[model samples]
Target: MKVSKLAVKILENESVVYYDPIYHGRTLKVIGIDDDPVEVMEYLLAQYKEKGYSIVVFDTSGHFPTGLFESVLRIEEGNPAGLDPLKMARMGIIKDPYSAVTIVQTIYELDSASTDKLYADFVTGKVNSIADAVKAKKNYSEIILEGYTDLDEMLFSGDPVRIPESGLIDLSGLNSVTLTGMAFLILAAAMEERRRVVYGLYDIAVLTFTGAGNAGLPLLTRPARRRVAILGTKYPLDQVLSIPGPTLLLYNDPDVQSAIYESQGVPAGLRAFIDKGEGAYIWRSPETINVEFGKVLKLQP
Candidate 1:
C-alpha cells in the first residue's frame, strides 16, 4: 500500500500484541480505536499526559498529510470549550472583564489598520497594557504581538506580492514544514488549554541529536513529563538512531530493517518479525533483545 494509505490503515485498524518469551511465551493484545487520526493522536497524548507513556513518535516520513491539521481544527471547532474570555479571566490571564475586552479591542485595532506604521504603532501602545494583564513570568502576548508585527513588516515590507486566496494559510510560497510547524503551534495551544493534551512533531535528526535542548523546542521537557513527540521523516537508521526513549517504527521499509539489524547486530530471523505485512516494529533501545513484532487486527468498517 501507499505510505499515506498505510498510515490511515494503522490508525484505523492497528493494535499492538505483546509477547514475553520468558513466561511460557504468553501474548497479549491491546485493542484500541478512535474516531480519527486526531483523536487517536489525542488519546496517545493523553496516555503521555496521564498514563506516563512519556514520548510517542509516529515518524510519518514527512509525507505527514496536510489535511490532518485541518481535521484537528474541525474537531476543535465542533467543541466549544477552548480559550474563552471568561476562562482567561478565571485563569488570571486578565485582570478583569474589561481587560479581556481590551485584548480583543487591541487585536481589532491592530487588524483594522490600513497602513503598516499604524499597525506597528497600535502594538507598541498596547504592549505595556497586555504585559501588565498577563500574570505569567514571561509575557507571551507581548512577544507574539511584537514578533508578529515584526514578521508582518518583513513579509509585507517589500512591494506586496499578490497572494492567491487559497486556504487559511497561503501555501503558494511557504514550505510544507513551515506550514506544519505553524499549524501545530496554533492547534497545540488550543488543545493544551481545552483538553490538556500536548502534541508536537519534529525532525528525527534534531530530536535524536539535540533532544530537548533545541531552542524553541515544542515538546515539554521530560520532567514536565507529559508530551508526545511524533518525528516524521524519510531518513535512514544512521540518521534517525539517537532518539532518547523507546520508539515505535511504523513503516515496513527494507532499508530501515536492514539498517536496524546492521546497527544492532541482531540475528537474520529478526527480519521475519520486523517485516510483518501490516504492523509496526517496536524497538525499546539499541539492544538486540528489546524488539517485538505485532499487527493491527482488521476490523469491520
Candidate 2:
C-alpha cells in the first residue's frame, strides 16, 4: 500500500475518481476517525513529494515529523531563525510591502495609520526591518515591536528565511492564536507570491491545522491558485463538505456520513462500505468511491 499505488487508485480509474492537476488543482480534506489524521497527512505528504510536487506544510501542532522534510522552520520562542516578513518583502518573496505590514499587524494589532506609514517607509527604503524601525524612533515601533524581540533579531540576523521547495513550518512554538495566525499569513503570502512567478502543475501546499481547531478555519478562506490539501480534526462539518475538490473521509461519524449522503447524493448503503481504520470514502467530482488508504512508514530520526 505505497503512495504510488494510492495515486494509481485515485487517478487510474477515471470512472470512479479522477485527480489530474493539469485539469485542475484539488483541495483534499483528510478527516481522521479511528486513525490519526497526522499519520494520514504524513502518508499523503510522501505521496505528493514522491510525485515531484513542491511542498510547504503549515504544521500547527509541531507534532509533524520534521525528519520527513529537507528543511524546517521552527517559529518557537527563543529561536532566532523565525520568519521575518520584512526580509521576505526585500527578497520579493512577499510580493507587496503592505502584506508584510499585514503580517506585523496580525501579530501586534498595529493601527492602520501606523502600518501604512511603515509600509511607505519599507517601499522607500527609509526603513528595512523592525530593528530599523526601532532605531529610527518610529512613534509606534516600541509599542508594536516590544515583545517580538526574537523576531526583530531574526529580521537582520543576516540569515534570511528562504521558503523551501519541500519543508515543514512548525508553528507549535507560537502559543498565542494571533502569532500562529500571523505565521500563516506570512507563509500564505509567500506561497501565493511564489506561485505567481513560477507556477507548476504539481506544486502543492499541505496545511495541517489539526491542533488549531476552529481558529484554523479563518486561514482557509483565501482561494487557492495551486493544489492545497487541508488535514484537520475539528473543522465544522458543513464547511468541510462545502470545500470543492476531493475529500477523503477516514472518520465514520454518523453525522458526517449523513451529511455526505445529503450533500453529495451518496447512496445510504455505501455507508457500510467504509471501515473504521482501513476502508474510507473518497469523494471526487461526480463519484464517491470506497478505497483503502496507503500504509505509511514512519520516518526515522
Candidate 3:
C-alpha cells in the first residue's frame, strides 16, 4: 500500500474517513496474526524518518533492516565495537544506575554481595571494565570472564560507544537475559544523551522494538522528556493494552481478537464480520475504528 494510505482511515461507513497522522509520542502496538508485523513497522519507520523523527530500535529479530537507520550497533561475537557498560557508567552517561546494576547482576548471576561490590566500584570509578573488576576479585573472575568471552572487547573494554540520534541496536543471537541487559544499557545511554541535548520543542523520538517480547518490557517503561512514538510487536497483548496509548492491532488469534473487540466496545455480532474483513482495528481514546494499513515495503538491504 502507498504511504498515503495510513494518513486516513474509513470509519464505520465507507464514505466516512478520519484523518490519523499516527503522530509522534503516541504509543502504538501493532500485533499481527498470520502477517509479518515487522513489515508494517519498517513502513512506519520510513515515514517517521521522512518527517525528521530520530529512530532508535532495539531488535531481537536479526532480520530487521539496518540500512534504514544512519547508525547500526550489532551485538555479536568479535564485533569489537558496541556499547560499553563500564565506560558509560564512568562517563556519567548512564542515567539509571540501579537499572544498570540490575543488568549486570542478571547477566553474571552475581550474588548480592558481589553485586554490591560491583555497584560500588562502578560508582567510585575504581573499575573501568569488566576485566578490571574480574581482576579485582578472584571469586567473580570465572563467571564474568566466561559470560563475556563471545562479546566484542569494546563492550567490556575500550572507550564508550556513542549513542546515535538514529540507529538500530541488533541484539539478536544472544540469550534473553543478555539481550535485556544490553538493551537497558543502550537505552539508558540514549535517553541520557537525549535529555542532555534537548533537540526541540516538537522533536520526536521513535523507539521501535521487534521480537523483543518480555525482554523489551523494561526498556519500554523508561520515562522520557521529549515526544516519543513507542512501537512494539510480539509483545503480550494485555501488557500493551495496559500502557495507556493508542493501539493499532492487526489480525490476531480469536482470543486476542475477541479481547480487543470487547475492549473497544465493538458489538459482539460485528466482531466476526470485522475479523473476516480486510484492514486492521485502531483503538484511539473514546472509540475504535477499522482502518487499512499501508502496504509493507520490500525488505531493505
Candidate 4:
C-alpha cells in the first residue's frame, strides 16, 4: 500500500498509537509534535532504533537534534555525483521539473506480466542499478530522501548516499550551509553499505576535548541505533562518536571555507576530485557572502 506521509505529535500525554493485527493486541506507539520537537524525535528514535526502522530528517530549517543516534556520519568536500535535475535540464535531458531518469542500461519493452510489474517498480524506484532494484524490492533502504533540490545537485550518480568500504560521504554540494551535513553525510552513506556506524556526541565532548552541549548534529542519525563513523572538524565545535559502525573525523586543520559551500575558495575545475574524498585544500570560509555559481564545495580540499 502506498503510504502518505504520517505526522504524529508525540508528547507526554498527547499522541497517537498504531496497532498491529499480526501481533494480536499489540500496539505501536506514536508521538505528538507539540513542544520542543526534540522529545518527539527522541521518542521516535528510541522506538525505531532496534526495530531497524531507518529514519530520515529533512533539515530545511537546519536543526538536527539527533542525540539518540549511536553515531554521526560525515562527508568531506565534493560536488554531487553529477546526477542532478538542473544539470540534466541544462543538458536537455529533461524538459520539466518533475524528473524522469532512464536506466544506464538500454530499456526495452517487456511484454510479460511479471516483467511489467517489475518495470513499474523499477521505474518508480529512482534507483541506478540491479542491486538497487533488489534492495528496493527488499525495502532495504528504509529511509528514502526526496526533498531539497539544492542538495541533490552534487551527485553524478544521482543517489543520496554512495557506500564504499572506506565510509559514507555526501556527494551533493547543496546543504553546505551547516557543518552537520558533512558529518551526517558520511554516517548515512556508510550505513547504506552496512547495518550501522558509530558517532561521538555530547558524552564524548564532556569526557574528552571534542565537542560541547548538543552541537546540532548532522541529519543522518536516528534514535537508539549505534553506528561507527566518528566526526571532528577544524571549526571549534565539540566532537563525539556515539554510533557503533566504522568512523572517521574531519582533519583538524585550518577552517577551509570551500568545504562549506560550492564556490568561494574552490577552484572551478577538479570538482570531482574533491568528491572523491581529497578534502585538504580549496577553501574560502574566511570571506563573507561566500556563495557563488559553479560548484562551491571544491574537490581539492
Candidate 5:
C-alpha cells in the first residue's frame, strides 16, 4: 500500500487514546503499530505537509533515512565540545581576534614541524586537533592563551553548544538529558527563524534521566504544528503517556509492550507476520492491520 494510505489509517483511528486515565483527557496520546514504521512516519509527515500542516520528527534512534532531509544537525562523539571548531565557526560563535588567538596559540602549542600543515588544515575545515589543544590549554604547561577579545569567553569556554540549521539532526553520543535539551534549543530556534524542520534524535533513553520528570515529557505536552515521532524499543509509560499525539511502535517486542502496559496501563498490540516480503500483520492496538514494508529503490553511485 502507498504511504499516504498508512497515514490515513493512523489518523483515522479515533479509538486511539491520547489521554491517560489519571490525567482525565487533559493530554494527548495514541499508539500505532507497524513494521518498518519509519517509512510509515515519513509518508504520514508528507501527507500532513501536503495539506499545509507542519511536522517534526524526533528520531531517538538515529536510524532514519539521512538523504530525505534538507539540512542536518549532528551531535555525537565525532564532534565533541573541544574538538569541533569548524562547527563553532559555522554557527558564528567564533570570530575575529578571539578566533585568531585561539588558532595561533594552538598552532604554537603543537610541535613546530607540523604547525603550517595543521594551520592549513584548520583553515580548510580539515582538522580540529589544534582547536582541541587550544581548548585544553590548562593541561599543557607550555601553551598559554594570552590575548583577550570581546568574544573571549565564547572561544575559550570549550562548550560546543551550537544551534544547527533546520534539517535532519543526529544527536548520537550525548547523554539523554543533553540530547533533549539540545533538541529543544534547536527546535525553538527553528520556530523563531520560521524554518521548516524534520529532526531526529537517536537513543531517547537519555531524555528520561528522572523517570516521569524527564525533560522530553514537557516537549511532548506542548502544542505545535510539528508531528514528533519518538522511536525506541522501550519508553517509560509516563514519558509515553505525555506524548500529545500519535505514538508509533515499529517493533512489537514483549519487553517494550510490557513496559508500556506496566507503566501506563495501556495495551500495545502484539506483532504478527502474516506474509513475507509483501507485508506483515500488526494486531492488537485498537484493531488488527496489515502493513507494507519499505524497500530500497536504488543504490547510490
Candidate 6:
C-alpha cells in the first residue's frame, strides 16, 4: 500500500492526516460514480478509504465524503466555510441547499463532458450539485490595479486572477505585509462592484499588524470580476515606508532620505486622495494602470 497525506488549509486547526496503504500497489477498484461534484468528491473519499490509496487529497470544498468512504481515514476538505454566513450563502451550500444526493447526480454529466477536453477543474458548493458550487468564491474578472514595475504589470495585464470576496488573500509574492489589509479591501471593493469603496476601519486593518484597531471592516458579499496588482516595494523609490496609503504614497517627503532625483516611487501628486488615513487606492478607470513613481512597460508592446 502506498500512503499519502491530506491538508486542511481552511480548517482553523490546520490538521494533517495520513492513511496507511495510500495505494494498494496494484489498482484496487476506485470509481467516482456520484454525479454531484460534492457527493462525487465524498464518494471518492469513501472509495479511497475503502480501497486505501497510497496518497489522497479530497480536492473539494469543505465536505467530508460519506458512505463508501465511511471507514476511510486521512482525507480532508479545504475551503472550510468561515463563521460568516454570506460566504456560506454564496456557495448556495447552507444546510438545506447543499446536499449529497443532488451533487452526485450532477458530476456524472460534467465528468462525461470533461472526459476528453483540455480543461481545468474546480469544486463548488452550488445549490444544485456538489461540483457546481466548488470555488463559488472564485469569480475572475480583468482587474487592473496600480502596477509599479515592468514584469509585474505584464503579469496582471496578461492573465485573469481571482479575487476572493474574503479569506486569507495571499499577496505575499506581490507586496509588503503592511498592504495585506488594503489588498483584501481593494478586492472587496471590486467584489462589491463598487465604482469606489469608502474603506472603513476594519477594511483598513486588513493588513495592519496584530493589535491594530480594525473592527470596522465591511464584509460585503457581492459578485466579483477582475485582476490585481499592488505597488510599493516593487517600484523604484517607493515611499511605502513613509507617506502611507498602500505604503507607496509616502515618497518625496522632506524627511525621505532617498537620494536626490528620486521620486521615492510615491508619486507625491497623488497624495490629495489619501484621505488623511494613509490609505492609497488604485481601482478606478479603464485598463490603464499608472503611478508616477513607476513607468509602465507594455506587456506586449
Whole-model alpha-carbon lDDT for candidate 6: 0.24
TM-score of 4: 0.25
Better of 1 and 5 by lDDT: 5
In Å, residue 263's CA in model 1 sits off its true spot by 5.1
As a TM-score, model 3 comes out at 0.65
Output the worst ten-in-a-row residue range by lDDT, candidate 3. Answer: 196-205
Worst 10 residues of 6 by lDDT: 24-33
The model with the greatest lDDT is: 2
lDDT of 5 by residue, 1-301 (tens): 2132113333222232121112121122323333244554454445435655434444546666665556656555323433233444444544432343333433234344445444455566555533453454333313424432223323224554544443555544444443344334333322332323332333344455542224334434443333333333234446554444333333445565455444443333433322212222122234433222322112233
Number of the top TM-score candidate: 2
> Which is better, 3 or 4, measured by lDDT?
3
lDDT of 1 by residue, 1-301 (tens): 2121112222223343432212211111111111122223333433333433332222213322333222221112112213333234434443344434333333323342222333243344432233332322333433435434332223222221221111112222323343223323222222232222233343333333321122113333221322224333334335444433333444345666566455544456655434333343333333344545554333232
lDDT of 2: 0.54
RMSD of 6: 24.2
Residue 123 error, candidate 5, Å:
34
The CA lDDT at 114 in model 1 is 26
Q: Which portions of model 2 show Cα errors greater than 4 Å? A: 1-25, 110-112, 134-158, 195-230, 234-242, 256-273, 278-301
User: Lowest lDDT 10-mer window, candidate 2?
Assistant: 196-205
- Overall lDDT per candidate, in order of appearance: 0.32, 0.54, 0.52, 0.29, 0.39, 0.24
Each model's total of backbone clashes: 2, 0, 2, 73, 11, 44
lDDT of 4 at 238: 20
Ranking by TM-score: 2, 3, 5, 1, 4, 6
Model 6 error, position 225 (Å): 16
TM-score of 2: 0.66
lDDT at residue 291 of model 6 (Cα atoms): 29
- The runs of at least 3 residues in candidate 1 whose Cα sits more than 4 Å from the true structure, single-residue gaps closed, are 1-71, 74-227, 230-240, 261-273, 285-289, 297-300
For 56-169, candidate 6 gives per-residue lDDT tens digits of 222112232233322222111121212121232234322322222212212122343332221222223222222233322322110111212233223223112333222223
